[model samples]
Target chain A: MKQEIQVKCSKGNLALIRDFVNRWLDEQEVKGVLANQIVLAIDEACSNCMIHHHNCDGRSKIEVGLNYEGETIYVEIKDSGKAFPIDQYKPQAINDIIRKRNKGGMGIYLINQIMDEIEIEQQNDHFIYKFAKHLG
Target chain B: MEIKQEKQNSYISLAPIGDLDANSSLEMDECIQDWLEKGESNFHIDGQELKYISSAGIGVFISHLDEIRARGGKIIFSHLSASVFDVFKLLGLTEIVTIVKEGAEIAPHF
Candidate 1:
């Protein structure tokens, strides 16, 4: 099955993105734990796109696509915004983060941990983030 | 979704139902800040119904840790959802944030 959704690049609108993905996952019979993880990953990706790529400019748009084939689920979050530096992405040190108690730098790290694989590519005038998960 | 509040002993207990994402993160921050300003400390978020939390929601706790510490306050979470707790565990937040399971002491995290 496949589905897609478009949302305004506003933080307040992230729930719609999350709820859409979540309903799709539920229909695919993805396990609850895994589904929750996928939901967070999708949420974080869109959030990153809105906050970083679009610079919190709510006028832009974020398009999300979801597809499930057998035991694999694929999600693509696309936006017409600045491309992210995927190669240069690095998670902050956990100890330092805990000591300093900072939260700003953990979203990408959490997304990486939750999603099995991710690929970022700029196509035409939009940046597409592809994240995949394999269900057992 | 709303976060229910109560006064439990020395802790200001909060219970959130449904997901805690971007839209509600600010509300969480503001709620805690309001309590802090009102001389309420020993924060305890009852996570039984808290199914999900993104960075935006967790950021509120992290941002206020310093201020709460300075006030000799503590923040603790109880009965976190397995997936939600996994995120916290993955981030090593269990070390910094007090998370109590059933029958565990709901102690202060300072």
Candidate 2:
């Protein structure tokens, strides 16, 4: 089964993200630690798109899609912002980044750490972040 | 986020519960800065109930780290949820900040 949602880049939309994920997770019968992991990963990815990618411009919206294929759950977050330079992006060492007090780059790092697999691609003006994890 | 204050002697314990994301972090930063300006520096952030925190929230802590250290005060975190702890660990804050597993552990340091 698959589900999809589009959220604006406003603070109010965060609750909608949470609600959509929680409802989908419940319906999929995903529970316990696995469910929590998915929720956190999805939250981080969606929040990154809303806050960092679009900067709450109201001109952009985040599209979140979820797919369940019996064995695993897949999530994709699509943003209509300018193409993010994923090639030059490096995950900063946690200590170094913290010491410098940088806030913007940690989203991708956290998403990578939390999700089992993550893939990033830029198509035209959209940046796509796809993540998948097996539920066992 | 919910903030509750407890004062003992010269130390102030600021307990913030729930997700400390970008939107809520500004108020938190102001609250901490206000306390620092008043010369209350010894802080224990009771995070036992705090479920999640984003980089923006962590930035607020990092921004005040130097000021707190300069004043010979420290901000300690305790009882972090596993997921929150992971975020802190990923940010490499585990080494710089004093993290306690229990609220009681905070007493000995202060």
The model with the greatest DockQ is 1
Which CAPRI tier for candidate 1?
Answer: medium
Candidate 2, A17-116: lDDT as tens digits: 7678878999988865556567767776777667667787776788899998868888988888564543345787665654565545676666666677
Q: For residue B79, give model 1's deviation from the true position in Å.
A: 2.1
Model 1, global lDDT: 0.82
In CAPRI terms, where does candidate 2 land? acceptable
- Residue B34's lDDT within candidate 2 is 91
- TM-score (0 to 1) for chain A, all models? 0.92, 0.82
Tens digits of lDDT, candidate 1, A34-123 = 788888888888888888877778788999999987788898888885678653579877656545866578888888887777898887
**What DockQ was computed for model 2?**
0.46
Candidate 1 lDDT score at position A94: 64
**Candidate 2 wrong stretches, greater than 4 Å:** A86-88, B103-105
Per-residue lDDT value at B69 in model 1: 75
Per-residue CA lDDT of model 2 for B1-110, tens digit only, reads: 77888987757888887778766788789889899888887988888677667776777777777677777988888888776777778666788888887636576777
